[model samples]
Target: MFFFFRKMNAVYLAAITAAFFMVACQTNPNAKKLDTGTEGTIHISVDETYQPLIDSEIKVFESLYPKAHIIPTYKPEVECFKDLLNDSARLIIVTRDFNQQERDYFKQIKITPNSLLLAWDALALVVNKANPDSALNMNQVRGIMDGTNKDRKWQLVFDNANSSTVRYIMDSINKGKPLPTNTMAAKTNPEVVDYVSKNKDAIGVIGVSWISDPNDSLSIAFTEKVSVVRLRADNGSDFVKPYQAYIGIGSYPLKRGFYFCLKEPYRGLGSGFATFLGSYEGQLIIKQFRLFPARLNVVFREANLK
Candidate 1:
């Protein structure tokens, strides 16, 4: 009888231990195996304007690390921030960093979010091939944005109403003023190009990446559909296109920084990917996309020709 009682007690304890581990696993899926820098899966959000560049980044990253999988959702910058705040995304790539309120909220939650300036991006103004006005100075650009230009009837088109490009224009160009009453909103950058291609009087605001990739057939097609508008600064004499060298030299009129905000508490896949972006290889990819790389040091030299 004593031996039988001891055996029954051992069986009960083993069952209890099994149940405890099961409950722990259910509570936290990563309890059994924690995600590391080079391994595991993560979800991230990216601004739609950066889809082309980021797609290449992810493809290379996954190929390098077969154990790591990153699922990304492309949306507007505002929506990307919403995903970061709601804990739906481990990282987000957008035009700006976290504001004061966002930093405060993360502090309150005892989470320190990381922000990295990845590259310098340019906003390209495109018009129909038949549109004769393919160049504008700062004053004319502002007038068109604010609906104050009376020289010509222009229709302004944007990728989305809440996109980062619109925000940049309102804050930097328009000086907190509202957009024009007749401004149109296309669903995506490609759609904006399409709209401008069809409307001879329309001007489309899009990211340079959409039409800058020389190797991409779609990018070449976009350039064929519309002509990129040359922009002159308020005090500058020459009109310049949004070339990578112009952006690097501060000659481009419309430029913004690309950033990544990460919410991972541990050194997980998010941190790994962010590190990769700031690495030498990653910056090379960015430069190939015709954007000025922030992490890589590039020198410009002037030559005297006869």
Candidate 2:
């Protein structure tokens, strides 16, 4: 009887040991979560145009959630999406949604992003500070881009190849029209500004957020070097500069929404950040960017109403 009891006790101890090992493996640090578990570092990638807004937002979020750290990578708008698709990033802050082709590409990879339109922005055209022109009508702008009308010629400049301004000009102005081979491309917006400032015929097209708010030191510096261009309809009669008031009132024709692309709904820190952006504080930041906030609020700007 003692021998039999000894053998049985040994078997019981072995079973407990196996169970403990299983539990330990299940909680292994490198183990994949059963449900895409949380508590990992939040990797965010954003387009250069939204660098100011998103960088500031991430700082605020970190203050709110100390344990959550956001590693933000900045790239051109097109490259930002590429990073998300390639799994280098889990979140994307951009100005537009993925079209059908992009959606299909993600589907091929079995990764679907949740696109959240966080705020609205408008593309602004800028010229040298010494240039007297303050505005260009949509038609004139298109004419210059399409290379159809030579009289409206200006040395059009663009940001990096993957920038949102390049995309916008392609979509809104070119519209499949063959562009002139003479247009120049700058490596960066600052380069474009420098080129425009030095040349009388140069016009720099950039994301409005770059200079939308004049309060920032960088923005003020840019304004001192280059003048923001406005758009008018038809024959340059109703010239309108890109502004929060103009975009809010639908007077700005180039307004578009910025989005937060996520892989999941409200399951992770991405959702929390999105929620905070939709809140009052986020709207305030949007207002500060000189773009229309998601929620309606009265913003004051000096303009001639006549």
Which candidate should be chosen as best, given TM-score against the real structure?
1
Task: Give the per-residue lDDT of model 1 (tens digit) for 137-245.
Answer: 9999999999999999999999999999999999999999999899999999999999999999999999998877647642223368899999998777889998888
- lDDT of all predictions: 0.91, 0.74
Give the Cα-based TM-score of candidate 2 against the true structure: 0.80
After superposition, candidate 2 runs with Cα above 4 Å error: 1-40, 105-112, 214-222, 234-237, 295-306
Worst 10 residues of 2 by lDDT: 32-41
For all predicted structures, in order, the TM-scores are 0.88, 0.80
* lDDT at 68, model 1: 91
Model 1, residue pairs in steric clash: none
The root-mean-square deviation over C-alpha atoms between each candidate and the true structure, in angstroms, is 4.2, 4.5
Estimate, for each residue in 95-150, the C-alpha lDDT of model 2 and write its tens digit. Answer: 88888988998788777667767677888788877777676677777888877767
